[model samples]
Target: MPNTQRLLTARNIWMATVRPNGTPHLVPIWFIWINERIYICTAPESIKARNLRANPNVSVSLEDGNNPLVVECTAKLLDKPFPDEVVRLFKSKFDWNILTDDEYGALFEFTPVKWLLG
Candidate 1:
């Protein structure tokens, strides 16, 4: 793993997956590393979730050391609608007090399986 402070203190690049028709879907997302994996909160029925279900195969890239490191693998739903504790945890990271329950629910949960972080 890259030095959390050295490589990630200001890093924002994250792995984003999507299905672009017949072609493979892949893109980099700007994210925050929560707990042990990079995360994003999205609706379950969103395109991203659909694509992940149809094709678990995935790829990710993260800043490692002094350069960008890439990983190819799959992801599984570790959590959805994030648990209350998880939500509170993430909320602490941002000004979540202003958000309503439904607004907060818009953020979901996941974890990287077979991840490769340099």
Candidate 2:
């Protein structure tokens, strides 16, 4: 089983995406790991969202520097009327509802392809 405690309890994760010019854009954001996939919500016009639109490849790492957990993944933008489970998880974890908010741009699902933990 995945390390549920470590993953879900993490306060923040650093998400890195590739810019159109081949540079990297990284930011700290709230996330939830469910079913082996990482889910993050942000404005569609955000830099990370724009970058993901151009290139789906992404890297995510927990905030802890002493004992780090990183993963490489591809991001997929979820369509309107977001998944029920995703919304529920976000609510329980973050107490925020992405579905009822106009501030949230879109929900992005990141599927891990590789991991680096120490």
Candidate achieving the largest TM-score: 2
Candidate 1 residue-wise lDDT, 1-118, digit = tens = 5454432343345555657575665544434455665544544676666677677666666644467565554656553445565556446655453135443234433454554655
Tens digits of lDDT, candidate 2, 9-94: 88689999999999999999999888888999998899999999889999999988888888889999999888888899889998
Colliding residue pairs in candidate 2? none
lDDT of each: 0.52, 0.88
User: Where's the lowest-lDDT run of ten residues in candidate 1?
Assistant: 97-106
In TM-score terms, candidate 1 sits at 0.56
Count of backbone clashes for each model? 1, 0
* Model 1 misplacement above 4 A: 4-11, 16-22, 28-30, 63-66, 78-81, 96-117
TM-score versus the correct structure, for each prediction: 0.56, 0.93
